[model samples]
Target: MSTTAHSLDRLIDESVFAGRIYLDGEWIEGGGGEIASIEPATGETLAMVGVASAADVARAAEGAARAQREWAATPHPVRAGVLRRAGQLWEQHAEEIMGWNVREVGAIPPLAGFALHVTAAECYEASALPSAPLGQVLSSEEPRISLAEQVPVGVVGVISPFNVPLILGIRAVAPALALGNAVLLKPDPRTVITGGVSMVRIFEEAGLPAGLLQLVPGGAEVGEAMVSDPRVRVIAFTGSTRAGRAVGELAGRHLKRAHLELGGNSAFLVRADADVDQAVNLATWGAFLHQGQICMTVGRHIVHESLFDAYVEKLAAKAESMVVGDPAAGQVHLGPLIDEVQRDRVHTLVQDAVAQGAELRAGGTYEGLFYRPTVLANTPRDAAAYCDEVFGPVASVVSYSTDDEAVELASATDYGLSLGIVSKDALGALDLARRIPTGIVHINDQTVNDEANAPFGGTGSSGTGSRHGGVQANVDAFTETRWITLRREPGQYPL
Candidate 1:
């Protein structure tokens, strides 16, 4: 093992990776070939993870289907107990898990730490779901009783993305398990260890029954098998808008329930009455955090014409001040993109924006996968950087003369994921927020924000359905309802 790998051993139990795939009760070899997990920070192979083939996906689905009945039969308290224990395990190994996130996914400390915290919180929050009332009685005619009860959707296929892997994966996995559904998780290939394997070990240690949760990591082939399988009842996906469209199409063809949390080009609007300094600070964090890989990152800034110049200058300085380098080196405000492809995509967008007359205000340089936090000013509405989802540390600023134009520009994008409004007038901000077409809007704050208790999802191209936190959100997505009626007496219309 290399020095970083050795450090990982000290962080979590070394046995977590001994066998790559977790099927049934055993950790076994994968049928697919091996994939090298490269560390984006150093362009080095951090580890070799076994990939899952179509056969491997089939086996996992079979195992989940076989175990669904018994697992669902398990009492709600017993299920809740397992989830609670898993949450405790997450808390116990928080540092190690966060370190894995940093090493494997190139996440800076703050974002990595936040992911760990929210993932653990999801476990705890999901525990309460099993005990909540899943059904209700309805008024009926005399001598008749009617009731509706919630039931498990059976096996769920979870395909999670590389960005925010832990929280995203667990947000689906934890809740599905709580609702008595089996999960076959296919994590992003780049983050298999932290995203898929870690959760398996945690659930196993928490005494979950065999075959309830399976981790199979692979590329698109494996994902296709999992999603197309007839045995899988529900699919929860988080990734780009393009890929999400494919998943949704497949789910529709199969008539399966699909919950998708897709892409976002969220906007940050600063009103003339807003505090420029505070808005700038929030925008800095929202745009550059995690190299702006977050789906909710502030991709566009629409500032009042009065404060546009000041906001641009302050934001440019802030972007320039951000440190982009190897996350493990310490105190890095921004880190490398997940890989070269993402870096190149971000660079192309910036270059194209500049070519189309946008001013490169600050920090448009790069070294390998590490790109500096970049700011673009006076970007036209039609420019790629301003119009599309730049999933990197790049922020586009534009000035608007009227509030209607500001709202129109913010709402004009194909995405309706998140919107941020900053203003000194709280009531006015709220009023504007109500008019924004996005799923979630923040007042006096930047676009990037998430909590375990909020309805954390998007609209239109952003997502197909909500992946809100808490038990209520899970129940709606992970289960089905059945209505039953009983007649206590015979009818007078008998023959």
Candidate 2:
């Protein structure tokens, strides 16, 4: 198959663009390393993803360091133009990108389209140079002067995950390149063919210089190398908390900068007076969108006792009607889990919860990688599924007689990424929103995640550092804040 996906009749050509690894401005094998990626839907061997050794990561980092200075010296306006052009190229290739996202990453077409939209906007903003913050040149009482400036860090190593690959990867790469920093991106092996390679082409299409962006598509060893590389000044990662801790440890040891967007068990609360219909519809997005692989997907739910049974019945019924099948079909509401491992994990969670006495009001079984859009109610607080992230289409719900209980129930989890509330009283909703311990709170809707421009990240187990709103995870990851002074006279004042 051609790199361009639409030219082929089917979504996945299976003959080309499969198992290909693009590194350091070239597509090559992992030397002695190789791994296969099978279509979870049919168990067909689609392609092989190169498994890079730690040495390959070191080479990529060296390349990034070598080209970083030149890239940092490129004029800012020209850099901005390149990014804008990249956004245009991204639009041109949306079809191929979306197809890869659907077939390889197992994202439904609608969600893939949304991911592409976010990618275009993010790349444009990341590449488009921001107005330098102006400094006030006020004449000081001590008769002093002032100055203004901005500078670039060296090389950044970006490690992204399977869910929302394009957005998360470029979320670091775009800003790093635009800010005159070179980038070495290690895209998750699952969707690197489209998420990683296509991103490189977009940058090249927009006139980015060679070596400005280097990609290393692999698994664990590469991740370790990227985070621990002495030349890689910054590391941006999105994955699990266990992995985030490992990254944090390595960063601490090496004095490297690491930005982590870890796991989340976001909660959605429905009050007694909430619009039941709206809450049920919101369930579709909050719990099952992208099959709940999102870091901020609503995995834990709290419903007022007044509406608990009614809401559970409605939500479970809606989920039961959902179509869990081929992502390319365009008629399905939900798709299969990424692979067998994730499928088994989801199944284990649901089964364990049922065994522990939680009421499984809906699906609790799996057919290969397909875990039906499932829901659970009467989840006892002690049940493992009650407060943990299932990371699948499974939703665990508990009842709360008071709003205070809702807040307590929501905050009980170690994560604090996001929380959604449904209340008839506006003030009550706002009050709960303020009290809820989460980075994002939605009052009337269940989908708490909003615009790409918004500041998004989590608290506690979720993560440290923000992903959007101009606070790049890279530069902000490891930085030293300083207070500089400009003196009018040659003599300096004492502290």
Candidate 3:
């Protein structure tokens, strides 16, 4: 093992660091070769992870198909037990997991800890699903007992992204498994260790049966294979809107269901009645958290014209005050972007917006992969940063004169995953929130937030209407419904 792997040996097993793919109850080399997981903050190679080819994905899917029957047949309590144990394991290894998250995803300690906490909470919440009501009795027109029941969707394919890998990946995995479905997980190669390898280890240690969850780390090809695989009945995807469209289209072609949780350019509104300082604090946290990599991060800051200038100035000052560095090396408020590709994309958006007449109130530069938190004022609606999802630490501020205008500006984008409205008048803010079409809304809070039991998803380009979380949503996403009827005697059929 290399020096980096040696350093991680205590946190992660050496066997995992040996760079193997977990499939079909075995750890083996991937047919697609390997990818090196790099630390964005330092540009250091943390681990060499095996990459799964399309063929490997097919094999994993087939194995999952075979294993699902038995897993579904297993006692519900027993399955729930495994998920409970996984939740405990997440908490037990919180420090270690946080360490991996910091190195793999350029996450600050608090963000990494948040991922850990949410992941554990997800597992714990999923544990309750097994015993939840799965079926309901219905009165039949004829003399027969009718029932509508939920059943596992067989093998489920989960494709997760690099940002907030643990939480995004586990939210689907835990619920699907607790519902007695097999899973084939495809994590981004950049975050293979934290997202893929850590998951496999956790389940294995928790006594989950083999072949139930396969970890395949690769890029688009592997994801495509999983989505197209006949054995895979459902696809749970979390990623860019561009990739989600392809996944949804391919799943449709195959006549399968896909739960797509795609990208978002959420809006954060500050009304004239709101406290300017408080609004600035919320906006900074919403826009700069995890370097603004979250899909729910506030991409558009819509402030009332009366408080717009003050909000911009305060936000810019907050951005400048934040420290950016390698989270693993020292204390810093923010970390680097996941890689140079992401850094460049973020910078390009900021530059494009400035060229289009958006005033650069603060930031718009980088030292290495660490992008300075950016604040833009007078951003044109057509500016790339304002119109698109920058997925970086960028706060694009725009002013609105009235509540109606604020709603119009906030709802302008094709994406509508989350919305935040700040106002002392709770009823008025709620009224404004009701007008916007979004999956989640924060009355006093910022856009970036999540709970394991909440129904999470969005409308429009953000995602399919299918949500993830809560007993009902989880059942709907990972299972299928069947109607059964029983007759006391032989019933005459209508001719």
Task: Identify the runs in model 2 with alpha carbons over 4 angstroms from their true place.
Answer: 1-20, 134-149, 448-450, 471-495
Give the alpha carbon lDDT tens digit for every residue of 368-395 in model 2.
7878888988877777677787889888
Write the candidate numbers in order of decreasing lDDT.
3, 1, 2
Number of backbone collisions per candidate: 0, 2, 0
Model 2: worst 10 consecutive residues (lDDT sum): 3-12
Per residue, candidate 1 scores C-alpha lDDT tens digits across 112-181 of: 8899888888999999999999998999766678899999999999999998899989999999999999
Question: What overall lDDT goes with each candidate model?
Answer: 0.88, 0.76, 0.91
Clashing pairs in 1: none
CA lDDT for candidate 1: 0.88
User: Which of 1 and 3 is ahead in TM-score?
Assistant: 3
Give candidate 1's error at residue 252 in angstroms. Answer: 0.5
Off by over 4 Å in 1: 1-19, 489-495
The best candidate by lDDT is: 3
C-alpha lDDT of candidate 3 relative to the true structure: 0.91
How far does residue 135 in candidate 1 sit from its true spot (Å)? 0.8
- Superpose all Cα atoms of candidate 3 onto the true structure and report the RMSD in Å to 1 decimal: 2.3
CA shift of 146, model 2, Å: 4.6
